[model samples]
Structure formats: structure tokens, C-alpha cells
Target: MESHDRLCRRLALLAGTAVLAVDYRLAPEHPAPAAVDDVMRALEWVASRPKELGQLLPGTGLAGDSAGGLIAYLAACGLAGTPALPDVLFLAYPNADLSLSLQSVSEKGEGWGLSVQDLAFYIAQWVPDASLLGKFSPVEVARAQPLPVRTLLATAGHDPLRDEGKLLAEELARGGTDVEYRPHPDLVHGFLTLDAVSPAARHAGDSLLAAYGSLLSHTAMLRRDRNAPPDAPNGAT
Candidate 1:
């Protein structure tokens, strides 16, 4: 929780928006299902206090990195039918599939900081039974009614999770959800968070923040249009 709070404080300075970095439990020691359950609980917690969250920051959105990215997707799905949809979802090199069939895992070699073996180890610790992949995998989840909230999903060219991220974006778009997907060819997994060292990482982080700002502007415009009095002489008359 302290980590999330500290990161949110840092990101708030750049995004010009109040950021809420959720600290869901980790896997292996906790198992995949438990990790997902933790995220669901956090989602429910936030939804329950919408007024408080709104007062803290008018725009309430969710953002995550790596495994947390996966949780963000699940969190969105958890709120699928609820009235408390997050205004935005920002993902960085998200792992959206448990199938682990993404080509980059093998074809791209070790250029990405993450390796296929590392992923396999993580999966083994989280999901030992391959047969139950569907239950735990985000991609395997059936398309929910109303689709997901507006999403901004980003991937790294050298990351194994790249194809999965694109696949997720396509799936969401097919389901009639709003999506904006971008991939940075020169980067690798966990880039944005590694900005303290890598220039490419910093660039990717800046771009993601810019995308969020654009979404906020559009949201503001929509709010203004909706709240404009009908009797007024502007476009609504």
C-alpha cells in the first residue's frame, strides 16, 4: 500500500491527475486465483467509495504495470455491469493471456528483459494445471455485456507480452469497447517503470501520460456538453 501511494504521488505530478496505484497481492506464494481475488476486492472497495474517490479526484482511473496490468483487465471486467466504470485504463506491457502462446516469447530472443523461462516459472507457480487455463486467463473470459471502459493499452516491441496486449485490444474492440493501443518498438517489458535509467523507458512513460491527458480533455468536453442548459443559446438550442 505504501508503494502504491508513493508511486501515485510521483505519477500525479506528471499526469496532472490523481492516480490510484492499487497494490494487489502477488502470485506464486499467493497463487493466481488469490491475486485476482485481491484485485476484485480492491475494485469493490473503490466502487463503494465513489463519492470519496471523486472528491479526491474527479477522474478516477486504473493503471498498472506487468502483472498488475493483467489485474487491471480483470478489474474492468469485475465492474462490467456496475455503474462505477473507471474513466480510463492504462496498461504497460500487460500479460492478458494464460495460454502463453505469444510468439515474441520465443521469436524475439532475450532482448526483452523478461524471458520465456521466467514466464514459465511464474505460470508454474501461479497455474500448475494447464487444463484450468481458461478459468484463470483474462482472454478466456467470455465477452461481458457493455464491454470494458475506455482503455489505453501499451506494449513494448521487445516484450513477449506484446502480441497478447495487441490481441487483447483487438478482442475488446471486437466486443465494441473503446481502445487505444500503442507499442514502442525500441522498448522492452517494464519499460515505463524503469524510466529512472533508460531514455526509451522515459519516453514511453511520457507518451502514456500524454494519452491519459488527451482522454481527460475529451471527458471534460463531453461533461460540458451534457451539462449545458438546453434553453441556452449554444449548440444545444
Candidate 2:
């Protein structure tokens, strides 16, 4: 998460909340399910005692970008149908389809920062056993179930994952989840990590993260005082 420190810090500032950054295992080193397991454990730890993180917090949320977004989605699915499920979800440019069956992967994969070949390598490394791809895929895992919570799903216009991310949002919404799908036409993949360098990326990324942070702030606020004024707007950046 070193590369994304800027985003985390900015989100904390904008939303007026503490951000717990979990250092989950990386792929090609620890492999599939390790990262997911780490996130699940972290969530369970938080849910087991929410008061420690924030006093009188109204809710909790799970957020991720790019590959982490994929893990967040999968983790949310695993935590579904329980009290541990998050109150909100924030996914940014997540490659929802691990099978690489989405159309944009072939049409707009190359020339962008993340190519199809590169994606294929990472995907294979994450799940060495091809047969288990479906089990780990958000598209496959979340098709029938609800999105687990209210979702703020964003897609990059020039990214190969654009289609699949959009598909995931649409399917989750169709399955009866409140979804706020934001297609960032001006941004690229990993915009959240590019905030410190690129103005447009910062604008787009901060706004999204800020939106999630706003929820956190709102939750904490309401929990502190049920009559704590009306809710603020969503995008705070």
C-alpha cells in the first residue's frame, strides 16, 4: 500500500476519519486466497469490535482499487449473509472477470498501462490453477447474490477492464443492490495511485475516495448523535 499512501491520506483528510490500511499479501509470492483471506480476517477483526476503530460509528466500509478492488469484491461476497458484511463498498476499476472473457480485454487492453498480456500473467500468477478462476472471479461469484452492500463502482474509459467493471456494476444492481456506478471517461486504470502525479487522476480519484470517506464520516457522525444534523453530500473532495 506504499504506492497508495497519497490516496489514503487524502481520503482521511477529506472525510475526517481514520483509515486503517491493511497490508494484504501480494500475488506471484503468496498466491491466490492469501490476499482474500487477509482482508476477510481484517474485516472480521473490525466487525468483532467496531468501537475500537471509531467510537459510536454508525457503519463500516470496504474499499479497493484495481486488483485490490477485485479482492474487496470477492471478500465482500464471502462475507455476505452475515453481520460482518460491510455497510458500503467502493470498487475502482476492478477486473471483475478473472476468466478474461470480457470483450474490452481484447479490444482495449493493449496501448494502455495494463495490457492483456500483462493482465494474463498477473491473473495466472494469482490463480495458478486455471480451474479455480471461476471461483475467484467476481463475475462468477457475484452473479446470483446481491452486491453485499451499497456500492460505488467506477470504471476507467480507456482501460481494458472498463467493460467487465461496468458489467459487474450492472449485474450487482440488477441483483437488487443500490449501486452508484461512475464511469471516469478522463481517467485510466490505477488512478487512485496516480493522484500525486496527475491532476486529472487526483481529481477523479480523490472525489471517489472522498465519497467513501464521506460515508465513514457520516456513519461516525450519526452513531455519535442520531440527530446529528442532515447528511452531507456524497462527493466531498
Candidate 3:
């Protein structure tokens, strides 16, 4: 929670945007839908009480790193066609695919801190029922029902989950969702949380903040243009 708060504070400052850090339930005990449910509820609350949430404008986006990223994506998927759908998604090294189909899971899984075995253990704890894996996995969700929001996906080149994030970005783009894929060539998994210790991680963090800010500003501009009277002059205030 401390690390998340620190990162959120940095993002809010860098992007000049309000950040709402959710403290969802953990896995192994809460498991599967518990965390997802909490995050979905949080999204709903953000949509319902925009004034309380710093008067968040339309096109408010969702963001997370690793497991939290998966939750954010899933929540966005579930909220599709609803008033609570997020305008954008920013994922950092997200575990989008749980099938372990990507080669990076084996090649860079070990020796980089997060091993394939560690991933398996976490998956087991989160989704003990193997059959339910596809239902909870974001990649599968994207395959079944393409994401309906713009996305900024950041993948760490040295991370075990790198390929899956890349694959998801490709799938989203192919499915017609606007996506900006950024790859950090020298970072590893969990780097977003290690910015305090690693210069490379800090640089990655800055890049993500910049992308997020730009996306928000662009989306807000589009919204304003669409809402303006059809006959209004270009660049009209």
C-alpha cells in the first residue's frame, strides 16, 4: 500500500491529475472475484460521485501495475456498455494472459526475480479452479469481448510477463481499440514499484506519467469538440 501510494502521488503530481488509489482485498484468502469485485465497485463509485472524486471529468481512465493492472482491465471489461466504463487503461507489465502461453514466461521467468513457478503459485492462489482461468484472464476477456477504451500498455523487456503484455496490446489494437504500446528495454517485472531504488524504474515511471497525461488531455479535447455545436467555428472557446 505504501509503495502504491508513493507511485500514485508521483503520478498525480507529474500528470496534474487526481489519483484514487484503491486498497482492494488480496488473494490466497480473498481470491478470484473478491479483488475484482472491489475494484469494479470502486470504479462505479468514481463514476457515480465524480464531484467527490475531485470532479473527475468524463474520459477518466484506469491504471495499475502487475496484478492490479489485471484487475483494472477486467473491471473495465465487465463495465463495457455501462456508464462506468473507463475512458482509458494504462497497464504496466500486466499479467493479462494466465495460460502461460508466451515464451517469455520460460525464457525470462527465472533469474529476473519473478519466476514461472512464482507466477503459477500466484495463479493457483487467485484462481484455484483451473477451468475458471480463462474467465478471469484479461487476455481471454479481450479475445472474447474487445476492450472498448483507449489503452496505454507498458511492458518491461526483461520481465517474464513482457510478452503477454505485448500480445494484449497487439490484440487490443487489432480489435480496433486505440492503443499506445511502450516497451522499456532495460527494466524487469515490478519495476514500477521499485522506482525509489532503480533509476531505470524511475525513468519508466516518468514515461508512463507522460503518456497518461497526454492521453487524458487528448481525450478531453475530443470530448469538448464532440460536445460543441456542430456549426461552431474551429478552435472556438
Candidate 4:
């Protein structure tokens, strides 16, 4: 969690967004659905305690990287139609599909920090059952139903999960959801955490945060315009 704290804080500061990072349980010890359940409960608590949450606005969203991204997507899907549902989703190099059907997995799976073998090992520990993979996959869910919120997907060119994230973005767009896709060709998986150590990763992280900030700001402006009093003068409250 500390590895992600810097990135989360930077994004929150840049976007004027309040972020609540969850310290969910880990795998092999607390397998499938434990982390998901914790996230759902955290969302519920956040939604119910706006005052404690820095008065989060209506456009509050979720952001995660790698496996965390997958959990974020699942939690969002699980809370769909409920007040706890996030208004937007941001995924950074997320393993959107557990099926491992993407070509990139074989192309760039090794030599990178996150390898296909590593992914398999983690998945097996977290979700030992092969049948439940589809149930927890965001790509499968997106193909079956429309994602209810705007989405921003950041993929790395040399990542095994790149294709699946792109596929999920395409599927969401086709379903009429507002989707913004950004691909960082020079980076690899887990760049978000590596940003502190690498200048290139830091630059990519800055760009991602800027885009996210713009989205939130624009959404806030639109909401304000729509809710303004009809008789209010232009440029006046």
C-alpha cells in the first residue's frame, strides 16, 4: 500500500479529488471475494459518510492499478445501481481478463517485471477455482452488460494485460459508455509504482493524473451548469 500512497496522493492533489485507499486483505490466505467484499464495504462506508470523506461530490470515482484495478472494477460492478456505485472508473494496466487469451501475454509476458508466470501464480493463489475466473473478470461482464459509468483506461505497450484492458475499453465504448483510452508505449506493467524510481514512468504518471483531473473538473462544471437556477444571469450565481 505504501508503494501506491505517493501516486494516490499526487492524483488526489492534482484532481482536487479525495481518495480513500483501501487496505484490503491479501491472497493465498484470504482468497477470492475477500478483497472484493472489503472494497464494497469501504465504498458503502464512504458513500454514507460524506462529511468524513471531505464532502465527496457526485462525480466521485475509483482508480487502481494491476490487480487492484481488477478489484476496483469488480467492486464498481457489484455496486452498480446502488448509491455506493462510483461515477467513473480509472484502470492503470489492469488485468481485465483472467482467461489469458490475449496475444500480448505471450509477446511481452517475460523479461518484464510482471510476467505471465507471475500472474498465473498470483491468480492461482487468489482464485484457485478456474470456473470463477469469468465471474470476476471485468471484460466478461462488460461484454454481457453496459458499464454504468465513464471509464479511463491506461495500458502499457509491453504489458501482458494490455490487450485485455484495450478490449474492455472497446467493449465499454461499444456499449455507449464514455471511455477514454491512453496507451503508454514505452512503459511496462506496474509503472504506477515504478514512477518514483524512473523518470519516464513519472512523466507518464503525470500525464495520466492530468487527464484524470481534467475529466473530473469538466464533469463538475457540467453538473454545476445543469443545476444552476434558470433565472440566474450568465457568469453569475
Highest lDDT against the true fold, candidate = 3
Ten-residue stretch with the least lDDT total in model 2: 50-59
lDDT for each residue of candidate 1 in 1-237, tens digit (9 for 90 to 100): 654454466567777776555565666677767766776676677767767665543445778878788877777777767655567778778887778887877766465578787887887778878888766666666344345578888888888888888888888888877889898888888777677798878877877877776786577567678877677656753
Candidate 4: Cα lDDT at 135: 86
**Residue pairs with backbone overlap in model 2:** none
Q: Which stretches of candidate 2 lie over 4 Å from their true place?
A: 50-56, 217-237
Listing every candidate in turn, what is its Cα RMSD in Å to the true structure after a full C-alpha superposition? 3.5, 6.6, 2.8, 2.8
- Give the per-residue lDDT digits (tens) of candidate 4, residues 70-127: 9998888889889888777889998889988899999988997788998999988888
Q: Which residue runs does candidate 1 get wrong by more than 4 Å?
A: 1-7, 50-54, 109-111, 142-146, 220-237
Best of the two (1, 4) by lDDT: 4
Q: What are the TM-scores, per candidate, against the unseen true structure?
A: 0.84, 0.87, 0.92, 0.91
lDDT ranking from best candidate downward: 3, 4, 2, 1
lDDT of 3 at 199: 92
For all candidates, the clash counts are 0, 0, 0, 0
lDDT of 2: 0.84
On residues 124-149, what C-alpha lDDT tens digit does candidate 2 reach at each position? 99999999998888877777667658
lDDT of 1 at 135: 67
Best by TM-score: 3
Return the TM-score for candidate 4, rounded to 2 decimals: 0.91
Shift of residue 155 alpha carbon in model 1, Å:
0.8
